[model samples]
Target: MTRLIKYAFLMSAAIALTACNETLEDIAPKAERQLPSRVVQTMKAKGMSKTSPVMMRIFKEEGKLEVWKAKQNGRYDVIASYDICKWSGQLGPKFTEGDRQAPEGFYTVRPGQMNPKSSYYLAFNIGFPNAYDQANGRTGKHLMVHGACSSAGCYSMTDEQISEIYAFARDSFKGGQREFQVQAFPFRMTAENMARYRNDPNYDFWKMLKVGYDHFELTKVPPKVDVCGKRYVFNSEPANGGKFSPAASCPPMSQPESLLTAYKQHQAKYDFAFNAALKKQSSSKQSETIAGHSEARLVADWSKRRARGEKVSRLPPNIPSPTAVAEAPEAAPTPAVAATASAYTAEPASRLQTALEAVAGEQQEETTTAATETPAAGTVPSPAPRPNTSPERTASVPAPEAGSQGTSLRRRIQNLFSR
Candidate 1:
């Protein structure tokens, strides 16, 4: 009787364990179908397997998304480029929850962040309001690079395109790439491009982003990014061998000497070309002034109208259909051009541009604000203090001052003018 009782207990425990395992499996997202043949072929051509680690770079102005795969040689190569079907807001970093601006910054994606069973076909969170965004008191949620080819404040790709992109990320994760970097930029960080927009209010911010951009360009490896003094600092180890603190003053640091030398040389060449480009552009056209109510003011006005029960006349911008996009030849990878002057591509005539024009026509009395204003030199303010006891930090950092909350919102709106 004792032997029989022991056998029954062991059998019951085994059944319970099996049931628990099954329950876990049931909750997991279903395995996706095999990668498309084209994607497979492209991976092979680029000397990458399905499991190769990847990095992505997005350019808002160019409407392009580039997938770079790590090669056997330990360098990343551009494996594919897809046109962004749609993106919202303008060419600037997103600040507020309802602003409808897709973000522009460095982000990371981990395996658990993937949503294989997504309403938008498939999706991956872009991990917005990152350390830098949080330190600056930016706010938003559910910012994603996803399928559906439509967006309110996300990077939208065609369903087909996203499937391929998603598969690359999924396989990379499976191959033990714990996280991959996503670098989103307002525009290609080229010397000529920078020179053309040098007077834009966001020029300083773009210059800062260019530092990371240059790092990748020189080494074909994503720079290790950290934040300090409320700005991004890349690819250096703290002199005292301590962990970097985003809101703290950056300690003395050093980078590999060869990498530093290469970067300096690249910058020298870029500066020479930038000067020539600036001179040529200045001679050719008077600076083209953007004549319109900035997107922020229009959004604010739209909100007011809605609250008052007025019918809004305009609709959100429409994205091009997949068929329409397929007919156009793929945009060639932008080549590094010499210092000789070349004309920048004119901004496309899209619904967003038309809306800006309409708003300008109506709000002629509105004061024009620069895209974003630069803080006075040598005025790096310390971040507001917070309790260090919490293991899980809050997404929203405390405002520097009670009154500064309003000031921060105004700055965000002003920054939208650059878009």
Candidate 2:
């Protein structure tokens, strides 16, 4: 009887241990994920640490996302550049709940917003519909920069790329930085691009963004962002100790005299550059205009282009391009052609050449782009094609008053500070 009881007890204990083992969860050790060694070496070389505060900038048109880390001097330096895997929507601010538009503006990310166990791998919310957006009555939720090469009104990055990015943010938070800033723009706010996009419906909004952009360009530091009168105000203080109200009229604002002087100097230079860019764009458009060309002449030119190895329309200008199976659909541009185009990408490209590149998929050898220009970000290379980046059922967003009121008020402030 004693032996039987002992055997029964042993069997029960064995069964209990097996049940416990089966019920235990298997978890991914994500929080402790470390930064890549190469990035660590780069930080060391750049006089930075893993714990330094970080900022991010995204250029939609350029398809670039840059990580800038603060150095000992408090100046930020570009530490990494990653091509956005995908971002949905047109090049504008998101307005509605289901627009599928990746937003463009400054956003903040706090520790609580980071999700290590994200369904899409790791992810972080870029607090959208901010004060300015709210003032303008915009609505959206859960916009994120996350892993998984997918986008649905979010900025998607590759798993490997996001691992490094997440590590950077995690390390910064660990070092006591409260939050980080993300500056998302349609493209690099360079004068040339500004001139190119001047006629766009979003110009006024872009102009407002430029003030904050210019502040950072001139100061090498993130501007203090505030929303007032339903617009973004950068690096300014209340003149009479009043507060800024997003909907109501703005209080009188002021800036440091020295900063104003610097801005005046900067603005003078930018104005000159902007005018030149505008003139160039106008001239290029005029030269490329095909509105008045005779069909015969267009056909003749088209023939010559086809002879020059250009993929051209069978019919004349304004006619639909060749869709009928004429020549096996020209089997995905040859490697040689792609290599040639990429090799000369560091050179400047004109609007016409850019159009041709688009038609030829930027993988063709023949193009007359521009003289010379640097990639938008340091060490950035030509952008790779991203999937699911096409705009979907996009609705027209109402232009914000920031383009007008903000412009006039910003100039008024500039004028005020100059004195």
- RMSD of every prediction: 27.2, 21.9
Which ten contiguous residues of candidate 1 have the minimum total lDDT? 332-341
Model 1 regions lying over 4 Å from their true place:
1-31, 286-419
Backbone clash count, each prediction separately: 1, 4
Residue pairs whose backbone atoms clash in candidate 2: 348-370, 349-369, 349-370, 350-369
Residue 386 in candidate 1 has what lDDT?
A: 56
lDDT of 2 by residue, 205-246 (tens): 999999999988888788899999999999899987799998
Give the per-residue lDDT of model 1 (tens digit) for 1-419: 99999999867876787877743333334446456778789879878888989999999999999999998898999988999999999977888999999999899999878988888888999999899999888999999999989899999999888977888898898898999999999999887899878888878888989999999999999899999877898898888776677788878888899989999999899999998998888765543334233443433443344344444433223311222222323431112211111332224345446445544443332223211343467998556445533322122222234445455444433343433
Q: Please report the TM-score between candidate 2 and the true structure.
A: 0.65
Clashing pairs in 1: 371-415
Cα error, residue 297 of model 1, in Å, equals 38
- Quality of model 1 by C-alpha lDDT: 0.74
